[model samples]
Target: MAQITLDAPASHAPVRLGRLLTIILAGQFMAILDVSVVNVAAPTIRTDLHASGAGLQLVIAGYTIAYAVLLITGARLGDRLGHRAAFQAGLTVFTAASLACGLAGGTGMLIGFRFVQGVGAALMVPQVMSLIQRNFTGAARARALSVYGAVLAGGSVVGQVVGGLLVSADLFGTGWRPVFLVNVPIGVVLLVAGARTLPGDRGEQDRGLDLPGLVSLAAATLLFVVPLVLGHEEDWPLWGWLMLGGSVVVFALFVVAQRRASAPLIPGRVAGAPGMRAGLVTIFLCMGTFGGFLFSVALHLQGGLGYSPLRAGLFFIPGAGGFALASLNWRRAPARWHRPMIPAALVVAGLGYLGLEVFESGGVGFEVAMGLAGLGLGAAFSPLLAVALTHVAVADAADASGLLVMTNQLGQVVGVATFGTLFLSVAPPTGHALTVTCVALAVTAAVGACCATPLLRRRG
Candidate 1:
């Protein structure tokens, strides 16, 4: 038995990593882009569609709900249908749905189309990491993961900026339509390039779809997320609470189904891997804090401080800049620096967040704090992925990738909902709200840092 090196292709001689990453990341970038971009365009959408409050909320939340619900199943599909095929198919659906979203005549139409777009995204996203797992090993894989992590961090900020610009530009009097339409051309280009560049499956075929596990999982996710996304908007109706309770039961059943199924949606051994398990928890805390921090800051800046959408969006740039700088060299950093990076990132980010609480003015102080937080974000993301996948078998990579992504999404939803509740209930001043959120974020980062301590002791 010998170690598999990234230089040695597992399938057909390895596709060029550069080309592969470009095509795969293009699709993922679009998915991540849509997540934040819609928030910027929400007002325009409501006005144009004459949407009611409930309808407006759906317009924003539908895509996320659908995207979250289908992710695990989508990863299984990739394993079964083949990654290249699944990737292209998902993009095609996504592109078409994006076009439909742009042309949507009413709120209902927009919400429906967005849900379809999410399904497409779910099908496409898992393949990005799974393919990276198949195509590259060790250091090359580390670099590729670093690139992916950077895009994940930067793409959200890009969405903020681009969304603001597009809405404010009102390009061709299309208003919010461009936010959705923007994906159309990008999807077309990626599809064509991806077909040519992405690698095929590495001799593993789908071992049959686990329908029971999938249904239970989807039901659980739907139940869990619906309450989180809609509860606040709808004033926490009785049904919302019931759904939340039901989600736990459904999830328990899903676990039971997985234990019994011959071909489980998630392989138990992969989930059981010690490092992977810890990584998943750390990822949840990291992403939950990240999501809550972003939402809280955006609300505070816009609602409390009276900054316009464009200005608030611009405010996030320094952080994105810091993330770019750190992630660009993440893979090149020394091995000894790798494990220490997560806790260091957590400490840096926590301190920077504290600065956000203490700083009185918005000149150099704000930028420095943001930059530090951004740098930590990138550093933290890079190692988590690298370490989580360290022990995953190639056959289980897609499942692992899907689970990791799903946890991140769930964390985001939980973070937003929970912190948002506190934000609303406190009725604090702008500074106080920001401080509260940042304190929570700092605590979360610390927890994540503790979880990541295990990485320091892990050996090849």
Candidate 2:
């Protein structure tokens, strides 16, 4: 329980940021990749395991809800322990869980192991931001954040593409299992590299963990996520509605508890940091829209249009190019331009989605339209995080990062639940589905733009 200040003095040698980013991003890529990678393989998994629709839903939702629920506590652990130590611990858990997921015998075991993997991800991910805050400053920090954003956004594409390849490859006749098993060797290498390369900074050991605040927040998140994830699949039963209502009440209780706790899970000052709240709202909107779009499009292409999994993933390739172009050129803009970038990008992305309507007749222009959408995604993706944390205190980086990530996961849940439902209701000739999803995304982007307007008025 000793506090170790690992930030070396000014006169000491500086660490290479590249080494740090590589180590952190490698672990993060693994975690983020898992989120979307499993999607393409869902059908294969169901066939191989004889999973029902509801059961398959659980397999996906379990990881997401658990990851969202435990994120704040994981952030606190990083603050109470060293970010480096906490990250390493998370990596170890995640790597082991991935192996278990590959080796699972049935839907129940895979779902259980997926939840454990979420816990590990919760522990590892927040520290990536905290470490960037701890090590980088000024323009260097901006660049680092931009890269982080790019990687985070790009991970989805990677996951979809890689998942398709893995499922198709069926390495050693393992079927969908290799998609997960591939992580083992990569994780082992990253774990070793991270331990040696990351700085050894310990947190305040004397500060006790806020047990009550933790419970309330966990309950609040679970209450919100579990219902949305299961409600539609379960046909919106009464208990799900009750849980949704209960989440609101529990969340209020959490806020009250946090206000009184001596060492609160998330300190008020940090939560109230300038631009932080607005940034979080913007992130929620953007991520939610993007998540919904991805989920709906995947289903439409595969289930409705009858594209092969690989072809379905390839349909997204144009968007990836657009994103890459935007991210690569992001640093060229002035600081003042950052705030407006998100809203503008959303508009562009929205228009791109709207363009898909034109391709409905023959699906001829799908790739081109998606390319435009990807461009919009690229422009705003990193800036969303950059603008959100612009004024956050370094000390609270881990907590803020955890909260930001949780919001993102929640947004994705909402997107999937709401839009996924919409897609399912219509079914076939997915042009209508595309229109519905695009309109919703456009509206969400507009909301994000509105939230970001205040941040734009403030100095960068």
State every prediction's TM-score relative to the real structure: 0.95, 0.94
- Model 1: lDDT equals 0.84
lDDT of 2 by residue, 191-234 (tens): 89887888888687987789999899999999999998898889
Query: lDDT for each of the candidates?
Result: 0.84, 0.82
* Model 2: residue 258 alpha-carbon error in angstroms: 1.3
Model 1 clash pairs?
Answer: none
RMSD of each: 3.5, 3.9
After superposition, the stretches of candidate 1 with alpha carbons farther than 4 Å from their true spots are: 1-15, 202-206
Model 1 quality (TM-score): 0.95
